[model samples]
Target: MPTNYYKLNLASLPDGLYNQETDVKEWLALTTTSKGSFPPDSLNRVLRMDSSVELERIIGISLWMVGNVLPFVLPLFILASILSSTGLVLLKAFLTYVAVLASLNKFIFAPMFMKRYKRKQLSNTDIKDNQYLHTERNNQKYNSLQFVWPESVNRPALNDKPVIFTAIPHGAVPLGITCYPVWSKLFNDKLCHWTCAPVVLKLPIVSSFMKHMGYIPAKAKHIVDTLTKKEENVGVVLDGIAGMFRSDKNTEIANIKQRKGIIKIALRAGVPIVPTYGFGHTSLWKIVVDPFGILEALSLKLDISLTPFFGRWGWFLGPPQRVPLCVALGEPVLCPKIDEPTQDDIDKYHSQLLQSYADLFECHKASYGWANKKLVFV
Candidate 1:
């Protein structure tokens, strides 16, 4: 049975009950300037109305309805409709056509796309602003580190034999030496017939620049191809970006836990690993400390950073400390087959590479003042 309600008296209600009744005044004031009447219940009902039908109708009219209309467009539409209706064979034909177009795009259009993509990538970064200064300054100094030895010491000849040159800088170093004029001269005059295998050529912007400067991409295929043609002489950065600073009390070279793609490439190529060291790079920039670690974190996240120098110093090329750099190079560790090299072998070679780099750093630290400060790996 339905329930019934009994009426109650409101004559004894308190005046305080009407204290919050300011709505009428507000409504009256609003009505003086507008022709709208308050219809809260009606408005609520309209707002609560289901919109699913309208939404579905709009979507259907845009896509499904438009597709349905395409079949009425004469001979071409008739052929398309017939083919789609038949399925299988027609689908294969369409797929074949698409595959041909995709192949064309891959061979021709993709390279253009990559070049433009790389250009855009470089343009979006601040790598160009300080590129010349940072790269050239470090390259000049580091390259000169090789020339410092007495003529009596038997320096390795730049023969056509493939030798891996690895540069290990104590802290943030510029990445321009792989294609500097001094290196270019060395390659042209001494190692002219010898092809360089710089790992930087594998990087995006730097790779493009390296290619233009006659250094090809350091892919396994390319390295193998070059090695087959002539005995290739390659230069690789051992520490890469990791060697820039110490992390967890160990330099990036010291951290053997990560993948060393360069080491693997050298091993596969059967190239001699030569460890080169450069010091005094940390002195190039004044260290800015952020207590919160916000700025450092942001720089790393964005892959763009500033290393401010106190004053401009003329480029200085240190005498080549071959013993230190060569100590890291040690012996040429060979990996027979480029294709079948194992992960364990790669790891062992990478550990050896790190040890070589560490030895180079330790030997040259005194000369560069890097010996005093704790090498904190970031």
Candidate 2:
């Protein structure tokens, strides 16, 4: 549900009767135009439905369905139908044709969409008026997507420097990326790009959507070139898929002990690296365990996440739990430009990034109500 729907109150109605479609239609009609009349049962349904339920559904569909289920499942389904069905010769041929088209669509379609992605300058009023920013039911403050920095750190230092925001505990999904509207506001709507694994970038519709959201392939060449050629900031998941494999509600882990590529890129690009962490991201969804580690091995091998089953409240493939998302931006670690960075340079800066990220987590965990949470680096 959009944030505005959370404001409505349908009082004095019977219990256990709700219809989202009817209520949304009526709401839209009332708010947007008088062209359509409300359905007869709209009031009754509106009164029965809790705003939280709708919010959960929205979170589930947006995060789980869009980010996880659809992209991986659809292509696998198409390929399985094409290969395993021995009897349907004609159908197999058609499915094969469709698969080719989907693969081709991956390359041709996403760039066209990317070219048309426009950025509009937002005013103070525009940022304040954004309903999504106010959608955090857990917190009344519009700072649902909070960015906390150390008291000693200057805000303009972060604002002026071209940075590589290294986010952690990749969570069930990168919920931080989904909050583009809020974070983009923090950067004054300046376009910031994030790097993603090539596996997801090859899926049909998912690739286009990711491209529109400023995701590029997580290749060293691509990251280096983009940082060198563009004036915008770049974001990288230090833990990447390996970090996601370790994501659990009970145990918070960052698989970044060996991840030194981003540090090298930052040094080469002459940009500062910001150790970014998102609180409440891991609590959003619970991952079902693969006791034998088959899924884990496959995930690491393919460089793509393959959680066989995951959701909130034991609902398989359902929406993640509703929680206010907050990202902490640590003091930027300066990386001087080295046309050809050495092993010693990478090692020194990588240690700094780890310390900076750990410091960020320790300093603000209590403030963000994550006092008991500890970030373990694997």
Candidate 3:
């Protein structure tokens, strides 16, 4: 097994020597838990905080935000900063024109480009297609995020059969999930096909970027054709929109308990269902709760999250959270192919898949310092 990156504390060292007595305790307290799991009592104690973890979140989110929003935010800030001081009114007008053009590119050009890209995407086939250029790399090529998975176990290579990966506990931004395309390479690209939401493909500029990253619409026809193709693997964030609802820290809440349509699809396709979960997924956001259920109502209506959220940058979109996030994959559960699986059949396999999710978390959380996290069915 590849050794994970070590996060040891050099604070309170005995001169140049390391103390074995406090080593284990400090490692557990410092490196293992998510930011949300940090004890609140020590929150204000500046001396007790580790700068490295904080720095990662700040740096990660900064790059992500700059990449996502700089084209729109930077010009306006520059124009506003120099508008009053400028003696050249023509230069100010040019800057204003540039800002408006940027806005048009965001609001107009990008969405159309994405829709055209979607229209041109290739049909599903047994052989994997590189119809679009995706910079997403195999895990071996990605270094920014340390993705750890069980190395000792075998997944019975997805060579001859169709398979589905059911991801759980939809986090705020699912930054962890975004890295999955890179991580899924562990299972071999020949077997993986990503199913993305249609609305995500309708975003101004991001929609084009997402398609280039190999996401196809999650339509019934698309799914059926993909699965029917030899050895093609489908990845689904099975937890529906409700998974975005706020829950207690370290809770295993997933909307999976309420949503089980994947069960029927797997049964019909005769594919094995792989239960995947991300510990510390929710910690990516700072969600504002709505007591009267108004937020969830509006979110459902808009098909977007209503619970206001931000990252370290504390803006509309936050930076990468410093929280430790781990996405773990479990052994696939075989489902019998049925033309029409009754509720009992769906329920039976759903429960089994749910159990596999729980077991997967239990087996790996210790390595991720999430041993105390509960596997909530909700």
lDDT winner among the candidates?
2
Pick by TM-score: which candidate is best?
2
Candidate 3, pairs of clashing residues: 61-319, 61-320, 254-378, 311-318
Q: List the residue pairs that clash in candidate 2.
A: 60-319
Q: State which candidate, 2 or 3, has the greater TM-score.
A: 2
Give the CA lDDT, 0 to 100, for residue 215 in model 3. Answer: 66
Clashes of each: 12, 1, 4
Per-model TM-score versus the true fold: 0.42, 0.66, 0.64
By TM-score rank, best first, the candidates go 2, 3, 1
Error of 3 at 228 (Å): 1.0
Q: Between candidates 1 and 3, which one is better according to lDDT?
A: 3
Q: Write the per-residue lDDT of candidate 3 for residues 1-378, one digit (tens) a residue.
A: 322222222222222122112232332333332322222222111123334333333443443444444454556666765765553564566457546545654455434434533323333341233332111211101212333333222323554576787787776656545553332344444446567667766766566655655566777667767787545777787875577885685666777786678888888888878777766677766777778989888776755554666775675565544555556666567888898999999999988988878766666666566567777786
lDDT tens digits by residue: candidate 1, 1-378? 211111111111121221123232331222111112111121111111124322222222222212222232234544665778665455556446435544544465434434532322223233222122222222222322221111111123333355556554434333223323223223222221113334333544444544444455545666565554555455544444334333322232332236377667766666655554443333333344456766556544534332211212321121111111111123234444455568888877777766644544444344333344333222
The order by descending lDDT is: 2, 3, 1
* Candidate 3 residue spans exceeding 4 A from truth: 1-156, 180-184
Off by over 4 Å in 1: 1-160, 175-212, 215-231, 245-259, 287-338, 367-378
